[model samples]
Target: MGKNQKKKSNKRFWWVLISVIIIVGVGSSLFFFNFFGIGIDALNNSDTAGSVEQKDLSKKEEEKINQVRSTVGESHQDLGDFVASTHEFYNDTTGYGGINNLDWEEQKNKSEQVIMEIEKLTLDVSDESLKQDLQSILNVSQQAIEEEEAEDVRSLHRYFHDLDIALNDYQSYDRIWNVTETLKEVR
Candidate 1:
């Protein structure tokens, strides 16, 4: 090729390269900053993303809290009824000698139903400690029922005492807490 032609070709190549570089740089910058408001929208939309995510997390946490509250509330209602029923049963059966008779069997069946109801409670609690505490109460109640069925009044009373402690713990776990009523309300 001629020298002038070669020089002109080289100049054109350099101009194209420079122009391409500039275009690419500007386009990439715009895309990264979301100046055109396209794509994921989360890429560079602002700090609202954090806030949005936070709000979502907050909502989920609230839902969990409500669920736990509901379970606890159900527990309270059932436990109150159970306590009353048990006290009445104890009083009624004082002369029966043991809980092995038909009347005691009926009471035992009712207690089992209560246990099942408690088991059916949805426990979506976030706090591990609270969950453990609630589970402890359930365990005690189960043991007490078992002891009562075995016709061991002393053991039943002991288990009931432990259950009472767990119940107290649950009550003191949080003040102004009302779970059963909330569950009723939700339903």
Candidate 2:
């Protein structure tokens, strides 16, 4: 009986040891391969799934894109000029007070004019992304107008920041820099 019990104990110990060794070996191999960046491509199908190559645009498509880009660029420039004029009017102390003392009614009128100009500007592009961005800009502009009407300076500033981001032309560094400058001026 004692011999049988000893044999059973040894068998259990050996089984547990072998199981532990196998587990440790597998875990170590996974860690080693991952650390060395080995077999990672084989294990990960993410690159294949996520990396979609864009097809080359046709002549007509290229023309359309260029037209949209030009329109967006021109519109941005015109709006920027108008905003600068508005800023000048706001900062001017000839008739009113300085930057510290703004005429809310005059500011509201200027914002309304901006909204009107924004409404008049049309994208006429089929690109969903551009259309969405334009819509976001319009929405934020409207919100900013509302904040201006309510005389909420802080909320107006926040909405103006959102409007600047929404107006970002991802292709132009100059546009980004200009937006940054405008934001600094606003502050």
| Predicted structure with the largest lDDT when compared to the true one | 2
In terms of TM-score, how similar is model 1 to the real structure?
A: 0.28
Q: List the residue pairs that clash in candidate 2.
A: none
lDDT of 1 by residue, 1-187 (tens): 9999999999999999999999999989877545443334334422222211112224444454456545553455545344444544543543232232325465456556646755654244444444454454466556656665433332333233223323332231121212222212222
Can you give the TM-score per candidate against the true fold? Answer: 0.28, 0.31
- Clash list (residue pairs), candidate 1: 73-179, 73-180, 74-180
Candidate 2 lDDT tens digits, 71-151 = 543456654444345434433421121223345676566667756765665444344544444455456556656664322
- How accurate locally is residue 48 in candidate 1, as Cα lDDT from 0 to 100? 22
In terms of TM-score, the best-performing candidate is 2
